[model samples]
Target: MPSLYSAPVYWNEQQYLLSFYDPFTFRLTISLYIAGISLIPSACSAPGCISNYYPDDRVHIFRVPENPPELKQAWIRALHCDNIDRLKVVNVCIKHFREEDVEYIHKVPNGDGTFTSVPRYKLKLKGGAIPCLLPGCPSYYSSTSTSKRARLSYEPKEKEMLNQTIQLLSKI
Candidate 1:
């Protein structure tokens, strides 16, 4: 029985490492090596995330120049990424977005025994979308907490006015 291994192949003028393991015979074939293959860059766009694989539902792959500026800005604000620089070869993953924010989602399986789903081309993101809480992303939807903090940090003018009225009445 031949052992399973990875091989480097050139496809579409790009280099890819193909993994093959024939479970039936427990051997890899030579014809598989002759086939064309391509590899997608899996680095996620979320800040402080070092993920290099896209198998997770949170990991979304997209092409730049095809994405709108609004979607990019949301990621930039959430991830704190530099919008002016490092725009090339960057991808924003689904982990940074809420389900509603992602307008559309589609995936195609790469038929290489690896059950990884490749994202389709028509993925669209809703405008004014903000990233949800993910690693390194502070949750911005906690309005109640923010309101409490606001109350603790500053007294409302209305409260001060009410206090003054009470003091005047007490003196009278």
Candidate 2:
């Protein structure tokens, strides 16, 4: 009544009866399973997009927004024209938040007199803060309640490229 993997006698008997053991297939299957398991943590939980590669500089996966729906809507509006599917995976980069909205972790001395802090500086953004009005990011700036004419209005193009990249990632 033992399982196939738990019963070594069964495996030996099967190998003896077949006179062959496909170790390569077994190992390949095991390695594939392990690799798939390793990717689970990186999988995007966004509704429509299932991307796994979120580059550090370009994509900052903020903590999922609160339940009120205003935060998500604001992010979408700030990022400019949006489809629900694109909004599903919309994440803001550090550029989107005002400097004041983000909290910086300070260096402090530990009890033994050793300074302990993040190896690299990290900023924590508050949950309710909306995306900031960046001067050059047309998507953000124009979306803001500001003047329409921007000398450097290239964010629409950037959004297109970002969309293309996301589409490519999803296909992969």
Candidate 3:
């Protein structure tokens, strides 16, 4: 019949009720409920919508990644290993695709248990084309097949890491 938050009730922050004068049979009822619960979780008293974590103070994602088993984990690893800690993850390119991302990264082992840390620059949405198209380079370089020329041009540090990997591959 009537809501429970129509009167001047202070259940949370930014929440106050407004009631009207009802003089039919001498009974008081609530008119409506309003508040800024959406901004603060602690102020939320709705059914199944309150928790210890505050929505406003949550970890804001600087970037979101595509579907992958280890999306943020991979990027976090990259950030922790080298001097490229300022670049935040704006997007995920997907499994094996991020290798071509413009970020200067090195997939080196952190030696902290069994994880690898890779660091690189922010991924650019365009201008990523494989470079191994030159005459001197063969169609496949030691099994990698192709290398992102853009990676070499834009992120030499990353390219050098790749080169090192290629060198190891060639020896085996």
Q: Give the top-scoring candidate (lDDT).
A: 1
* Regions of model 1 farther than 4 Å from truth: 1-38, 52-58, 63-71, 104-123, 137-172
Model 2, 46-164: lDDT tens digits are 33333333323133345446555645555555545446444334454454566665666656789998987654355577545665454444442434332221312444567889999
> How many clashes would you count in candidate 1?
0
Question: Among these predicted structures, which one has the highest TM-score?
Answer: 1
Judge candidate 1 at residue 46 and give its lDDT.
Answer: 64
RMSD (Å) per prediction: 15.4, 17.7, 19.7
Query: Over the stretch 1-172, how does candidate 3's per-residue lDDT look in tens digits?
Result: 4443344657666566555344543445333345633332122111122222332333211233333424433333432324324443332222222344344554666667665647644333223322121122233321234333333345657778899999999999
Backbone clashes under 3 angstroms, per model = 0, 0, 9
Q: Model 2 misses residue 33 by how many Å?
A: 12
- Candidate 3 runs further than 4 Å off: 1-62, 81-172
Shift in Å, residue 53, candidate 2 = 8.7
1 or 2, greater by lDDT: 1
lDDT for predicted candidate 1 compared with the true structure: 0.51
Instruction: In candidate 1, list every pair of residues with a backbone clash.
Output: none
Q: How many clashing pairs does model 3 include?
A: 9
Candidates in order have lDDT scores of 0.51, 0.45, 0.37
Distance from true position, residue 55, model 1, in Å?
6.1
Kindly list the per-residue Cα lDDT of model 1 for residues 56-123, writing each as its tens digit.
32345544333555445434554566653555566656665556556564554577754555564666
